[model samples]
Target: MNQQSTLSSSDMPGFQLKALLLLGLGHLVTDLSQGGLPVLLPFIRESFGLTYAAAGAVLMTSNLTSSIVQPVFGYFSDRWGSSWLMPVGILTASLGFSSLGYAPGFWALLLAVFVSGLGVASFHPEGFKAARFFTGKRRATGISIFAVGGNVGIALGPLLAVAGYGWMGLKGTLVFLVPGLLVGIMLIISLGWLSEPQRAALAGISDGSRQGPRPLGKRWLPLLLLILAVTVRSLIHMGIVAFVPFYFVDVLKAGAGTAAKMVTVFLMCGAAGTLIGAPIADRLGHKRFFVGSMVFLLPVLWAFLAAQGMAAFVLLGLAGAVLVSSFSVTIVMAQHVLPDRLGMASGLMVGFAIGTGGIAATVLGSVADVWGVLRVLQITAALPVLGLILALAIPYPYKEAGQSEA
Candidate 1:
């Protein structure tokens, strides 16, 4: 294993800041496209006189397709080491999402959603690979920095939707295409710089000397537990996004604008948590920190459900910070488990797990229909117990790879 290639940021003070920032920008743009979709759903529903179930189907289709296909791309990326996917991912994501403004009917919108989902799926595995190339020792921190971009972009989606739809009508969606194109061009121009480390890694892999994936013998148990732990975390985070707005309006009697602001608080705080938690995870150990974060959530979620008004708001932000903080930690762990196939590890961590969360969203919504959103949230509060148990069992598989657990 070429341990020097994965050097710590402190060891190599001259890190690839330009490439990292550009990669972060691409993530921001792609997720911005994704984040905007929920905002557009209401407009589409109003224009088409569609039922809520039908409108939600648009999101479900996109999530389902993306979840299924991302690992395929990841597998290919590992084998081929393709640099084109990232730029192409941005371009296609833009095309699919931008077209939503002009879709004349239900099927047209569905088609657009599918294309946009594909773009999102294509970007992640390669994006994580690219981020790895730039970071040496501060892997969790670097991934967290990259992750904050997506969190910000997703948070910005609703704002863009409001501004675009309010100012220029549905056609305002086209504005998003401009940024995607510009970023894609920037990535293309920066390919030479980004490709250097990737070429070296590939060469190492070709010569059978690289660190990463190992044969899944007894190691499968830890990887499975980690995946399960992440699955629970994703479920809670996504559950908040899916249901919190309604909870605010229906239960707290907040106006639509206020509810929107609260959702923003949840997402933005999650981004902040990514930033704050990374350094802490670096020092405390990823497994211990992740387990502690999930265990801590039990009280946060209970308080959030039990409190009212300002107290609830504070708890919501706290919940967001604690739960979503594990996002990058889990991704880094996945790579450590299967170091050689970074692309595939990213696909499972980012793609497959999120899809599972989407299923949880669907099931939770159905449960909410019968049991009420408040009751359902109380049930969700208990999920972290499972994640905590899994975290305790997550073994350090990368000791052989010469990488320290973050």
Candidate 2:
């Protein structure tokens, strides 16, 4: 075997960097496809006259599919290589997303979402795994970069879709497909020259959880704890992201545009968290970064509720950054558990985290329906403190009983 082919991520060549950039771009477009859809759900329901539960089902399908399928993909991508599968998923997502512009009726619309859901769901295992492959030194930096790209995508989804709708109405929105196409082309063009990372990449460890780390043991304690903490994290994250605009409009008596800007401010803050928090985690250790993010957020969330005018928006932005960095920190932790299973670790972090959030959204939505959005957020604000405890309790793999194996 050629010795140069054995380069570790720390020694990854410039070609690898280019490849990773491509992966980041591809995953970004893919995520945009998924995250962008929910913003359009109300529009779909209103246009078609669907029930809330039915509309929720349409919105939820991609997440459920994404949550369930990534592990299978992760298990395989570890063995098979992540590069090829991602491109195929990108193409599928592009086609599926494109169909939404012309979807005929209830059945066809659901069909479009379901089809795109699979495509969107399929990308994560491979993308995350590949990011792990590309980054060295605990993979936090790589995961952070990859995560930020996805966050940008998720954060951008609604904004871009709404803009697309404004310019071309339904037809203009299809322009969103252009990003997917560019990414897919870049990936397909890049594949043949780049051989797979050695089996060593997949040889390090495994996690029992579909959402947990990929260390070599059955112990899933830390990962499970983090997942729960993250569920708490998401409940607050999504509630604010999804409902705040409406809250701004209906509850605060603001215009739709001002409400939209408020949501944008929150998401931009989250993007900053993704980009900045990774390096912070790298320097601070996962526990401090994860737990501290939760603690810091409690007050900001309170301020968010009490705030008025621009003050409320600013508080939302600040709280959002602190709260959501947990998403990035958890990604780094996933890599730690699945030393060998970068793709699986990534799938767990990317796919499962978001999927878990979907379930949380349902519960939060019901809470909002019953208790009202303000109270739902107010109750959610403090839940992350429990996340703080769980993150503090996270049993590191080296701390676990099967310690030496990883």
Candidate 3:
């Protein structure tokens, strides 16, 4: 291990703003492809004559490859430094998703989505680990900045997809290739700077010199609880993103463009919520902020389901904001619980938990096929209550003196 690359408690910088923002930009580009997929479902379904279940299976494929398998990648990143994965992952994701425009059949579409998802999965764990090093002392806030990039990308995805479709039909997806290449090249140029300390930190953790004091109880127990909480949250998130456009078009008689805009509104509000909520979480306690966000989500989501006209959009925005506010908090808590396995900690929180919820999307799609979209929305509304209970069950991990609650 390079001596200068190693991160010790004494030498870590307070914050590396430029590098952090660059990572945020990379995150934005990577997730932008993912965001575009949900909005394109209606088009894909119309073109392919897919049923709701099949449409959802497409999402499941993306989620499963991009998310559920993240831990495996994280494990490798932990064991052997893999900063190069960042830029390579970005380019691969871009190429894979952009191929959607030219896919000739349903199987081809799945293959394209799978390729793109692999790129997504490859980026997150390493991206998050690097963000941790760049964040220095303000871990929660820095992570929020990184996470908000993805939220914004998701929010913008609909508009980009809509524009692409309007201009050049399905082929417009090729526009995604531009940002991905640009950012990938930028990250490639900065590889040496980002890799050194990040690799050293991984090395330090592997050798046990950098591990922090263990939390009071069995770490796995709270981690399991936290994963459960995030899983429920992911279920609600995937359900809304996957189904809301359909609900607007079929139930409310809204135009497809309007439906896409609504999804954008939901996600943009989520990005804003992340920005506003993270600092407060640092002050209020991660567990309290997390549990409270779920409490806020339940009523707001229920009201959105019952609402009509403009009120529905307002409530939907609130629901998105409240639900997403806890995202960075949960990741921070997971890292605190498993100090020795930072990469795996990030993967479980951002990957496995979210992917599990995405798997529920397929189930919800099956329900929609039988019961209808309204029923699916109702089921989604009820999920936050379960998440809240799980949040309450998670024991606050023991903090060192002067450390805030995990």
Candidate 4:
């Protein structure tokens, strides 16, 4: 059998299912665990005596480190097994969160969260590789379903953190342990999250078992273009989300709880968008959605600031719903562009895009420093025009999706 054929699933009975559940769960855990910041930023700032800019920088580190580094790890996971990365990353991230609670000072806390993000860098490529191995044709739908759990984590994080912190002290917030533990347990039970049948088929193949991951084949140009577009999209995403809370407080004069809810609304819409985007792609096709997202988001985001109270909330929700759905489109585009390099695709979509966005968020925070939040968001809304052009650069049309799989 050819080397790729050697990967049939019969090699292990439950390996496929286990790998998938665990990997998805791992993604979900970090999403839930690190939610403390957005929920408690105001409190943390008051406690730490931080200015808005400084606190935003710390949050930026956690986000950027993972964003920037995930692609590197994605490339690695593509060549190596992702089996242990999730657990190890969770452990490190958990430790980071634990230390964050006890951090004696600001830099200490920032470094801890940054390290947490770095550890998170390991999951995307590895996880996506596993999902691809299983779903084969329906990979986009499958991965979207898996990824939405992360958004669920985002929704739950604030509620849990607030409840935990309310009941406990600083150490109480460390209750992130519960969610992380849930993921570890899920992985072990599933034998890891991959395809059961295919894994067995690959295992039973004729090639005498090899030890390492498959080699990363030739494919760099599309990856580069994907990165450029993804970088811009991610920056717009994080920059707006990061500052919305501040905008709520400073401009709209909303309460901390209200600001947190706005952030939650933005993320929630994103989560819903992803869920809908996946199915939407199944109907309208991915490329169409990719271009359409940019077109719709430009006006929605610009018009959002003009809204007030619940009106702003509804508009932001709609904006998030439409804009974030592009993630499904983008990730699918990346995977399609590099059919054999799912890990790198995941890395580009999840890692670099996020990291670059974090950096952009920091820089934009500075822009907001001078121009004000509304102006920054208004300008940031225009950034996606770059993505629109890049999306147009993507040559494969939706009509070809069915036959495009390698």
Best by lDDT: 3
How would you encode candidate 3's per-residue C-alpha lDDT over 1-406 as one tens digit per residue? 3221223444345578888888889999999878899999989999999999999999999999999999988877766667888998899899998999899999999999999999999999989888877777777898999889889988888889899999988899999999999999999999998877765555556676654434445566888999999999999999899999999988888998999988998999999998889899989989999999988888898888888878988998988899898888899898777655667788999999999999988899999999999999999999888998999999886454544444
Task: State which candidate, 1 or 2, has the greater lDDT.
Answer: 1
Q: What is candidate 1's lDDT per residue for 322-403, written digit by digit as tens?
A: 9889888888888877766778888888888777776666577567667777866777888888878878888853465454
Estimate, for each residue in 1-406, the C-alpha lDDT of model 2 and write its tens digit: 1111112343333234565666777878887766566666656667788754565566667677766567777777766665678888888887787778688788887787777878876787877766665665645666667667777777677777778777766544587778888888877887664435433433322222122233355547766776777666766676676567546654678765566567667776887887788777878877778878888888888877888877887898898688767666787677666555656666776677667777666666566667666876787777767767877887754344332322
Report lDDT per candidate.
0.76, 0.68, 0.86, 0.67
Q: In model 2, what are the clashing residue pairs, if there are any?
A: 129-343, 206-214, 206-215, 206-216, 207-214, 214-338, 215-337
CA lDDT for candidate 1: 0.76
**Which ranges of candidate 2 are over 4 A from the true structure?**
1-17, 170-172, 193-218, 397-406
Runs in model 3 with CA error above 4 Å? 1-8, 200-217, 399-406
Residue 385 local lDDT, model 2:
78
Give candidate 4 misplaced runs (Cα > 4 Å).
1-23, 168-172, 192-219, 397-406
Q: Pick the candidate with the highest TM-score.
A: 3
Clashes (backbone N, CA, C under 3 Å), per candidate, total 7, 7, 0, 27
What TM-score does prediction 3 earn? 0.94
- Total colliding residue pairs, candidate 1: 7
Which 10 successive residues of model 2 have the least lDDT summed? 1-10
- When 2 and 3 are scored with TM-score, the better candidate is 3
